[model samples]
Structure formats: structure tokens, C-alpha cells
Target: MTQAEANPRTMGQQETNLGLSRALPNGSGTEELVPSRYAVQVGEIEVLVISDGVLPLPTKMLGHNVEPKERAAWLDGMFLPPDAFDWSLNVVLVRSGGQTILVDAGLGLDPDLNLPRAGQVVRRLEAAGIDLASVTDVVLTHMHMDHIGGLLVEGVKDRLRPDLRIHVAAAEIRFWEAPDFTHVNMPPGFPDALRAAAKRFAAAYRSYLRPFDEEHEVAPGVTVRRTGGHTPGHSVVRLASGGDRLTFAGDAVFAVGFDHPDWHNGFEHDPEEAARVRIRLLRELADTGEQLVATHLPFPSVGRVAADGDAFRWVPVFWDY
Candidate 1:
């Protein structure tokens, strides 16, 4: 059956051949109000994963055919078949000492963003005992619509720019802030994902988010570094103090981030280069033994890379999970 023909609403799970259910964490391609989870302690850094909601789609937009199949080995072994896609978006709250830092903002009010509960960034922020105004800073890994959408609030009162030292890469700031992306050369009929992403990015740069560049220490022990690929200005975060070190590997990998380096999403400005970064970052993470964080993995979206046979695998860490 076609993706639209099979349980169109989005809750149906696409079970793997081995019966590993691969349903989108949220059926709607939008983020929804999720129940509260605990704030975890990582030595000195405390992180919380708040659900801004999810984006449930009909097919895996980044679908790739895997080789060496097993009985019912769905889509090689990584993706859920029937072409359905369900991706989640989250905002990470990091606390150290008395400092409150938000890793990335979610889709604040863009209906086009299709987040489950349209404007839950505020609610999610509050749920974690954080006040939007109190967030000493907001850090963005890139300017993709989903990653930076939550930086602004609707009301004149709840805005995100109130002294929050927003951090981004130089290339990232220049890319979206430019007026020509609406004309970038992408083929027609490019699904709503890319189109909407482009639109939201243009809007975000013009109205919200503070532009930043390489090596901005937004807070103690937190430094933003370049991890470009998803976008020109894409970046990853390095958090360290005493001995604990963490790298927020934004969108470097998606759902099954470790299965294949080529499992890059359709949005990467350059797919092959993105793959290169994935592999290189894997080495950096492993070599340095740094804690890694993914913006869209599962809840808590933070982990470390482990060697599984030949390829690197995403291993969610205890503190950030």
C-alpha cells in the first residue's frame, strides 16, 4: 500500500523484520506536549530534554536502501519501511552552577514547522524550572528551520533576545540572513520538508536569533565549534570543566545515526561533505572520549560514539539520557 493509503493518521508502527517497532515518537510531524522527565546530573552539568513535539511523516525522506537483508529486514536494516517518517524535535536545557543554557530552540510558532504542540518551547522551558528570561544564553548548532525556530516568542514580552547571548557560526549567520536562499537551486516538487525548512530559515534570520561565529564561550565550560554540513554555518558544542567534556553533535547524524555515514538527510547542503564530517567527528569524539549530543536522536539526545564491528554506533550516555 502507498504511504498515504496505510493508516494515514501516523500512529501505526512500522515494525522491523525482527519486530523492532519504528513508529515516529510522535505521529504528527509536529511536536506535541509530552509528559515531564527528570533532570539528570552529569557530574557538574545538569541536562533536561523537553519535548517541543515531533514531526511524523509518511515516508523516510532520507530513505536509503540497505544491503544484506534478513527476513523482514526493513529497508536494509535502519529505516522503517513503507516510506513513512517520524522525526522528533527537542530543546536541551543545560545547567551548571547557577547558569542556565538552552542548547537549541524548537519550532516556536511556525505552523509550517508542524511541531506536535505548535508553541511549546515556553511550556517545556518552564516545566524544567527554567524561565525564558533567565536562560543566560541560547546556543544554536545551525540555522535549519527546526533547530533555530524556538529562539523567538510571539508576544513583545516573551521574546528570546532579551540579553540572551545567542551563539551561531559565522557561515550560518551569513547564509540564512542573506536574502537569496528563496532562489537557491533546488528542484521543483521537493517535498514540504525542504521547502518549509528553507522558508522557515529565511524568516528566522530576518526576525529572530542572534548571529554568532567560531569560538564563542556562551557560558562557563561551553564553547561552540564548527561542525558545518547540514548548513554552511552548522556547528557542534563542546562543554568541559574539571574532567567532564561533552560535544553537542547537532544533526551530525539522524535517527539511526551510526548505521551508515551515508545515512545523511536530504537537507544537507552537501551530502558527501556531511558524511565526511560524520566520520571525522566520530573519530574526534572517540579519541577525545567526549560526550556527544544529537539534537534529534531520542529523548535526552546525548551520547557517545562506540565502535560496532566497523562502523561507529551512537551510544546514549547516562547523564544526558
Candidate 2:
């Protein structure tokens, strides 16, 4: 049976009922203080946005190209901290065409990085009653450590299906082989750590890799298109069904992007190209009025984009509960 069929309650129920009676990792039967998953139905397909916890990083990572004063002003206007803040890590579970597709795994355990609260995808998945083996396919937006680390966690491979298919852009796979860091302005140790994690993940899961050139349809109404910028092969996943649509925009757009699409993020290998890609994406999203989700927006980052003068605006959807 499909994972959805096996766990009908979790799939059928909405966020309002989540975490109320779910089992914890230690087998404790108790409700969590805060909800971490949100359910959205895109026609016949089922989309679950699971919070992978948060990463506390320097605020400058949001716009490394802009002046410090400009960055501070933006943070101040938003009432966020000037130095550092938590960047929400979100992972998605999509059930379509009798297949379960995990789009971007969260940051798995990386003790040396000192990010304690980030790698919770596995625990959260179990809490939601999603069996690792039940996952039929994984469509990676890119091979960034934060996007693929969950699968590299200890014992995670053994629990997954032996014949699982991992779909990713061929460009993404090639880019990581000899990644460029000349243009990026990441924090100390981040470049090496990201490099190590990506190398480890690729080495561990090479056999299951299915590389596509530009676009690939993993399931009905689900398409992943390559948009190189953040990395040489960054991409986004688009889902459409029964007249409803949503785009899981991996790293193409960030919270600051709505206000300053040209601001270069610290992790972008090609900041200028990344900025161009961001502008194009925001314009398309604003024109289409479809739902937008990303890896680093707020928790349950489901929203739509609207054209606001020359910039854009993020319009979050009202809860369906």
C-alpha cells in the first residue's frame, strides 16, 4: 500500500489535529507544545510541510552584498534581531500518483557545526507516522548539505527502501563534483562543512541517483526545473493538479528577496546570476498567484507572491483549519 493509504488519518487530517496525539521518538504518548506540520491539499495530491526545526545564523547571510546599515535597517523594520536569527528549515512530503516524494531533506546531525536544533526531520517524520521505507522517490532541489543531510544520518539508509529512486538535476550533480566558492561569502568553516557533507552524501547514495538534464516529471503534475544561480544547478519543484498549483522554490527566493530581489545571499556561488533567477521567479510567481513554499521561509512557509511596485510582497495563506 502507498504511505498515504497506510496512514490515512495523518494524510486525511489537517494541521489543527496534528501533534495532539502523535507518538514521540522515545515512544512517549503526549502532545507537543507546538505544531510542526501543516497539511495542504493541491487537488488530488497531498502536500505536508514539516518543520525541520530552525538554524540560528548571522543576519548578514541574508544579504551579504548590501551594506551593513541597509541590512540592519531591514531587520529592524521587520523587528528581527540585528545580529542573528533563526532560519526556518522546512521539508516537504508529497504524495501523488501512488508515490511518496520527499523534496529536500533537512539538516541532519552535524555536531561540529553547533547547530543543535536543526536536524529534526527524521524525528518529525516518525512522529507523523511516515515510514522511511515507504518513501518511493526523493527529488532534490539541490545537493546542499541542508537539503540532503537527513538521508546521510546514521541508520537512515538502512531504513529506506533498497530500490528507492533519487531524482536530481544532472547539472547539480556535476556542480558539486568541483563546486565554485570564489563568489560566495559564507561564514567561517561553512564552505568546508558544506563541501564535506555534500561529498559524503553523494558517496553514500550514488547508486540510487537519477540525474535529469533540465526538467523531470517524477509524478503526475509534479515537475522539477533547473534554475542555476545559488549553486551551478539550483532548481525548484512545481506541482499542479486540478487547476490548483504550488511551487517549492528551494533556495531561489528568501524572505528578504520579496523586498530586495537583487541582494546576494552569502551562499550563492554566482550572486549576480542568482539575483537574476530570483527576480524572474518572483515575477512569475506574482503573475500566476499560485502558492509558494521554500526551504528557508518561516515555519510552514506556504504563501503567494504579489507585485508591489518594482519589488514583491509575500502573502501567506490563511490557515485552513
Which candidate number maximizes lDDT? 2
lDDT of model 2 at position 205 = 96
Q: Which stretches of candidate 2 lie over 4 Å from their true place?
A: 1-31
RMSD of 1: 10.9
What is the per-residue lDDT of model 1 for residues 201-292, given as tens digits with 9 covering 90 to 100? 55654444556666677677777887777677888877787687777777777765476666645556766677788888887777787776
Model 1 stretches astray by more than 4 angstroms:
1-38, 63-81, 112-119, 156-161, 178-211, 318-321
Q: Locate the minimum summed-lDDT window of 10 residues in model 2.
A: 12-21
What's model 1's overall lDDT?
A: 0.59
User: Highest TM-score: which candidate?
Assistant: 2
- TM-score of candidate 2 versus the correct structure, residues matched by position: 0.92
Lowest-scoring 10 consecutive residues by lDDT in candidate 1? 14-23
